[model samples]
Target: MSYTKTQTNPTPFPLVKVGMGHLKIATAGSVDDGKSTLIGRLLYDTKSLTTDKLKAIEEKSKQRGFDYLDFSLATDGLIAEREQGITIDVAHIYFSTPAKSFIIADSPGHVEYTRNMVTGASNAQASIILVDARNGVIEQTYRHFFINNLLRIKEVIVAVNKMDLVNFSEEKFQTIKNEINYLATKSDFEAQKITFIPISALNGDNVVEKSTKMSWYQGETLLDYLENIDTTLTNDSANARFPIQTVIRPKTAEYHDFRAYAGKIYGGDFSVGDPVLVLPSLTKSTIKNIYFFDQEFDTALSGSSVSITLTNDVNVSRGDMIVKIDEIPTIAKELEATICWMDKEPLQNAQKYYLKHGVNDVQAKITHLSTILKTDFSGVEENTTALTLNQIGDIQIKVSKPLFFDTYKKHKYNGAFILINPKTNNTVGVGFIKSPL
Candidate 1:
């Protein structure tokens, strides 16, 4: 089964930038899909690895009696991972090219570690899903793509790896590409952009340099694409949302009257004189000032950790949210959400848990068990009674206090929450708010 070259769009070589900004990337694929090797290749070919690291890899590779360097050793950091030759936890690798700095999260591929993959990919602006050229599209590939779509990661690169093992065949790459494209049509996120690239990570083909073996392929190397892709687009462009983490008060003589709310801006920007409303209390006030450390600023953008003072001294404390007057989020006690169960214990109806949404922690209980969703793009199972580990499902939850939140699609930071088991204090599930119920 093969697809024609015209079936996939040809990627034009991107012009390299001198100094691009930072990018966070998460990798996903089944076990032995060469994910770690691809990352190691990126570091080695880009001259990002230090001398000591290279020497250690060479020594280890030789001791193992391998002809080529065991590039997977660069990212398989844990002893368990190295011994088993599989990633158990998310391994973060930081490297820089002349054009950009990258933080790659090497997520585990085993079925039991699906929660780890979700955590690794939650903050990524882009993702790279590796598919073994010899093994086409598999079940794990579907789960990876689904999670990326669920997280609203706009950019995805499907790197068909291990071309060397398959004799650098273009047909193999096309088959996998077609399978993934078909799956994309079933995805809820229609705007997700996917690019297909054929590469052999072990042999350094099409990773950092153009591959002569597959001359029929026409696309920028993996590094070239990473260097040129934009990382500025984020959910921060949505309505302004600031969740107060702490109330700062300097009772000292010089700044006796200063009462500022401190937290990182999650979405949109805030400026002096902007009308804002404090949540739960519903008190209104205008922004009096913004401060980052000891410095003062007229405006603070999203992701900025700054202290803000309101024109009126409305009583505010930790876990309180502030939002723009015009773009207020939903304030409700009951809501419906999609959740990924992460704990060993199954999720049951009317189960009590501590729901931590951003900086706010509230007592919450699952009131109703909805449908359990299939991760392979298959339709949902209706009337699901319970949710087990690695299972995703929809459910109705009632919180002790009103929550200020938006749908996950509308605002990433403000729309997510974690369910902590009251008795064990362990994160049992992660949820994305769907709507007020």
Candidate 2:
């Protein structure tokens, strides 16, 4: 595997504002599959590496008696990782091309580290699953794809790394692509879009620049494909939901009547004239004004933190929600959710835990351990007694009070919750509401 630096110039790609410029990408692949090298090559090819960082990598590579630079050293930060030549923890690598900035979560591919993979990819907008050309699709490939499916990640790139080892054969690439396509059909998620790219990450072919060796792949380079992604389209929502984080009241005597609900809007935009209903109490209100610090706006877009005043000073507090009347979510005390268990202790039926759903915390008890979903896209494992570490399953939970929520498929922002052990205060699991019960 070899590439000349002149194939393309590396330039700093400015991370875009809020929702436009930054891309969060998670990566998973088996050991020796070149995940770290791909990340390092991206940094190096894009001129994102500092002189000192490059020097450190170069010195490490040489000390190990390697003639060629070991790009993997760039991301394997931990001493254990350096010694083992494998990624154990999720190492976040940031870089940019001239078009867009990127944040890559280099998650481990080992089965035992599945929890880390879930944690790393839970909030990612995109993912990359690396496969060694010589080995084709392996067990870790299936696990990585399953994680993407479970998280409902919309866009995925199947990067066939180390293509040089397979002599850059077009037939080999197609074989792997067909396997992945077949696997996608088995996923419970129906609309996970996937793109295939054959590349030698170490050689930098078909990554920043198209590969000349395989003239067969007439597609955008990896970087070009990433740059062209419109995140807004992939992450669009229409149901306006505003979960109030706090009530803002200036005690200063000059403005004694100023009252506002402070929170970040999700799902859709909200204008001053939009009619909304406060949850739990079902209090009716109209948006009077929107304020960000001191500046004011007639409308507030999703992903913005702002304070909004309502025409009515109706009783509203933290944990209450302001939502468009037409798009009101299910108000329920019991929930049916798909949970990914993260704690070392198995999740037992009827266990009491504290569940925190976006800005709202409540006491919860497991009503049932329905079934464990297999990670290979196979059907569920029935009659499961308990959910063990790194296992995913469906469960019923009863909260202390009625809450406003949506299905994970409908509104990811308001549908997710975390289970914390009351004794240790450690997060035990992450749950996505499948539906209100």
Candidate 3:
């Protein structure tokens, strides 16, 4: 894994705008586990819902002869889902607090829709895994926990819902906690921060507000935990990665000589006059200006969406990367990765596919199938040949050209990619780059 650099300083440029900060969260659980109800409870308790929406929910609940409001009606929007009383797609809900804004991805929990759950949790900073108190831990719990561990979500909130039905028993809570704790030791995600909260989404106890019956429990409410979490827990700031999305060249009179490359900064910050390498081609350039909308800035930190103008007019375009010359990614043509197969048809051994990494999409082929990972995250199935839908497996792929990448543990944003079936133009799998070619 290696890359070369070329240095060139062109013209002095203007400043760039600042960045925006927000937290992204996702919710998961097995069917009938109150995932949607918990989200509705959060929104309702926080006063994020409108008066009309509340009235509508009340009317629908009464018409259905329900004594209590069905909060799940707030997000289960699909016609089929509403008729079936199950979540079938991803619902992205927005809410804001004084400390930080949040984007909640409500994902489906059924085993058949595990692919949609993966899509929802892929970009989340934290996740909420709901458990039905009556059922305790079950098979679907293992599946959801496995997905969370695989995605490397920083925080896990094991929300034990429907506590009211169980009489808010301390013994039941402890039992579930012990079970999850035991399973945590068997997983590869031991470093994750796990928090447990007992709540009744139907009655709104211990979810948004503290429960009076559960006097023995003493901890911050779920809302408090979510709002007070440190921003640093979401991403990394050590290694810097920039994948170029497009080359912006203003062929005008006022800025006739300007050449800018637009992309999002991933790992660390990039300052003006910092030396960079244009990957694959190994061309070198200096950062002259960083632009966010219409302002100027001296440096752009990780996760900032900005356009950077270079000192030299090298052959750079979409799919190319602008990275620090000294800290380049591994350049290779073969890769070993963990893949989550999403397509209905199982993976074919000799088929060619397109790998979309960052903003670059390139042709690739599956050269070897190594092992299939169990849902418990304990170990892999050695000597496997193919992966079926919703199956996770280790595979070796050969790409048409070398890709600049890092391990998923080091840099998730740059080390992750999606596999597309070229003929159907459909995403077939979600993959994490495990190592260089």
Best by TM-score: 2
Q: Rank the candidates by lDDT, best first.
A: 1, 2, 3
lDDT of 3 by residue, 208-241 (tens): 6777889978976787788777767666555788
Name the top lDDT candidate: 1
Ranking by TM-score: 2, 1, 3
* Candidate 1 vs candidate 2, lDDT winner: 1
Residue pairs with clashing backbones, model 2: 13-97, 16-21
User: lDDT for each of the candidates?
Assistant: 0.88, 0.87, 0.83
- Decide which is better by lDDT, 2 or 3: 2
Q: How high a TM-score does candidate 1 get?
A: 0.94
Native-referenced Cα lDDT, model 1: 0.88
**TM-scores of the candidates in the order shown:** 0.94, 0.95, 0.93
How many residue pairs clash per model?
0, 2, 7
Candidate 1 residue-wise lDDT, 90-139, digit = tens: 88898775456788988988888889989999988889999999999999
